[model samples]
Target: MGRRSVLPALCLLLLLAWGQPGAAQAAPADPPRAPSTVYAASPALAPGAITVHPYGQLQQSDSLDDYDTSPAASIADPLEPWNRFWFHFNDIFYLYVAKPAYNAWVFVTPHQLRSGLKNFFSNALFPMRFVNNILQFRFLEAGVEFGRFFINTTTTLGFADVAKGKKTIVPVDPTGEDFGQTLGRWGIGHGFYVVWPFIGPSSVRDSVGRVGDCFTDPFFYVYPWELATSSELALRFNALGDVLPLYEDLNSAAVDPYIAMREAYINFRNSQVKH
Candidate 1:
């Protein structure tokens, strides 16, 4: 594969890595790698203001078209060596632990059951989204979130996304609305890219957002560290199913997996902070 194809694959895998709350996301495609400028949220279109995805668009306006590999914005990487070490650690962890668990999980659970758990977990995390929306001053979206949460909890007990089809009355569920995006909206810079062990790719701002997200996650309400950690890990395990193909794609295509994944993550997260 040429350099182009590799990063998109890596980007997607990193985007879904760890299944952590407020994790970054991407469409696909990224600019050529440059040591001085591989990762960031840009210096702003003007002081204290950023245009929509200032580095580049995530996907094209046509919506059918995919990826615009324009040159990505820049951020200083003072911790490249440390980040790379953790990157490899995460790679091995995925290979030996996560993939096997995903296989076992898939082999035992039916698809409907898996999806149900996924929906339940998402529904359970409604407070995270709701609070972040409120923080970002997206009161409308916060209200919508509350409405959807009520509908889903009442109708399906949170097992199924029964509120999903009611777009006429209920808005479509939104994704990528969380503490990280809220921070970005409030003008916090990405700081720099870092590979956070099992959490995979993240930046300083996003890392902080993850901590904030933990406060609102349902896992926080559960007692006992064992129960909380296990529930959180199971959420990751159930989530692992959706991103397996992405991981394999990254594995197969990445020539210099670390740099490719790093740049992919940078570009991907940059793409997300806009919205």
Candidate 2:
């Protein structure tokens, strides 16, 4: 099927899958605690200082590995004033616009369909994964990605996740790789963090990588620019449909949702880069 025809067909399937009962709910939030494994360059932190360690535990100091989940090590935000402005703007957008759109979809849609869409998008982004895996010099991971894409596309129309199924022989690691991560693997710094309008949280390295990853998307090549852009937006919208319920609980639980999100994003991205 052509790219234009594919998304609509998927949406149709999603609608059909929506009526099934017993939709799963997002799990309740857990109590917060200090982090077990902290990411930092320092080996010899002062006693009671948040225990810090890098990706590889070569520090060989038992005291450093003590996992304490204090707020992640703060990264420099040179544009804090502007970043905070956009941060609140994005929060408002999410609260009023994106969340409502997601809510409307979730009310009508089944969890199964949402999961399938997430899988479909994950599978569809194989080109980005394959290229980045190669760039990272992880030939084995690149080969596994190639295998998963080949099998799933041929057998399941790229929507069904055969590689991830119980009967599957192919090993599929759904974690994505991109130019940003490739840069991370190449020892480039994160530069600085920023809260972009509509795009939410990101860093200088990741933002530039996002630009590069766009060209790696197969839809960019096969579809016209407008259609490709719309298709991507639709996919993202559908993906967001699954997580809408958690936003309220997260906001309620966070002492300061803005800081919580920023710290979480920074720490999470740093871990990804390290690994």
The whole-model lDDT of each prediction reads 0.59, 0.57
lDDT for each residue of candidate 1 in 20-103, tens digit (9 for 90 to 100)? 122233322222334433344321111111212322222213321122334324355678778878878888888888899788
Query: Candidate 1's error at 73, in angstroms?
Result: 3.7
Q: For model 2, give the 10-residue run with minimal summed lDDT.
A: 14-23
Per-model root-mean-square deviation over C-alphas:
10.7, 11.9
**TM agreement with the true structure for every prediction:** 0.72, 0.69
Give one digit per residue, the lDDT tens place, for model 2 in 6-46.
Answer: 54333221210000011122112223322212323222222
Best by TM-score: 1
Candidate 1 accuracy as TM-score = 0.72
